[model samples]
Target: MTEKDPRYRRAASAVKRCVAGEVFLVPVAAGVADVMSLYVLNPTAEVIWDLLDEPRSLNEICEHIQQVTGEAGGHVREDCSNFLTQMERMGLVERA
Candidate 1:
């Protein structure tokens, strides 16, 4: 997906689970068992992860972040965009 695109959701091929206070993402595929690795989300990222339970536009996610953290809209948008980009690269998320 392009960096300008904000409509995304968690990829179906990955599994997400919350253990303790952290969120873990694991790939689900044959032969992945041996190479499987966990991707953990930080507190802020956890919030974004949950928000992505359904397909959502980047602007919508940033709006929720602003409401929850009271951060400036521009800052929240940038942070969320960056986080989404990273998650996409890891195959944890995909364009909706």
Candidate 2:
């Protein structure tokens, strides 16, 4: 699909903010104590995470990034779509 499906969504306040020096992810499932894990994301993945702070559709995110960076550089949209899909699979985002 040229445009992303509008059903994708993200969990609210699910991400814990930490110091800016380094980026890390801590996944803590509610009603399931002692099941926390920390995930380390690379620079590109970190960018995706930052974008995901708000519930934005994949297409919208890609467009924003392209506009902000002033360079698609080729395949940015596809890369962003893939990143968004991965985030959804990782439970970092949900489908609305």
Candidate 3:
């Protein structure tokens, strides 16, 4: 993926599961993400997490969110981008 327009995928070292009604990402034992701590995904993050089941460009992700939520395109795009950046920083996702 190019630096300017990256595609994202869920990190191999991380595993996602639902506990009660909340979704969480936990690091596989002895995995890179183990040191990063368990992450409890918010609803927005959960949706993005599910979409990243397969590698996807940011625009594709935003489009899906917009379709599901019927929100303004520009706003949803911006928010989704920011959310992705945060997820990457936390070692939950990586460029594909």
Candidate 4:
């Protein structure tokens, strides 16, 4: 993933949950639609979200995924990268 805009930040009102093992997210601002969107995150995405409290570089996230998987996560690197790109575009995550 490339560097993101410094001005972008996660809205504190966002809500997320893992239901039936799939992740769901909703932007919880007033006047926003109540309908939540389901995001079927791959294992790599799951790892990335699990570490959201800390700002991590793309390489750092990939390493964490590899550690959890007991092997290099190159197979899912593109998938993870794409997921982050989408999340950034959606304002689901922000650069620190």
Q: Write down the lDDT of every candidate, Cα atoms only.
A: 0.81, 0.64, 0.85, 0.64
The window of 10 residues in a row where model 4 has the poorest summed lDDT is 2-11
Off by over 4 Å in 3: 29-36
Candidate 1, run of 10 with poorest lDDT: 27-36
TM-score of every model versus the real structure: 0.80, 0.66, 0.84, 0.68
Q: Pick the TM-score winner.
A: 3
Alpha carbon RMSD to native, model 4? 3.9
CA displacement after TM-score superposition, residue 19 of candidate 4 (Å): 2.9
Q: 3-56 in candidate 4: lDDT tens per residue? A: 442222344545667778777666666756346554556666666776665677
* lDDT at position 61, candidate 2: 69
Question: Which is the winner by TM-score between candidate 1 and candidate 4?
Answer: 1
Error of 4 at 39 (Å): 2.9
Query: How would the candidate models be sorted by TM-score, starting from the highest?
Result: 3, 1, 4, 2
**What is the per-residue lDDT of model 2 for residues 6-40, given as tens digits with 9 covering 90 to 100?**
64555552454455766666665673422356566
Top of the candidates by lDDT: 3
Give the least accurate 10-residue stretch of model 3, judged by summed lDDT: 27-36
The digit string of per-residue lDDT tens for model 1 on 29-94 reads: 763632357887777888888888899999888888898888888778888888998889978889
Q: List the residue pairs that clash in candidate 4.
A: none
- TM-score, model 1 to reference: 0.80
Report the CA-based lDDT of candidate 2 relative to the real structure.
Answer: 0.64
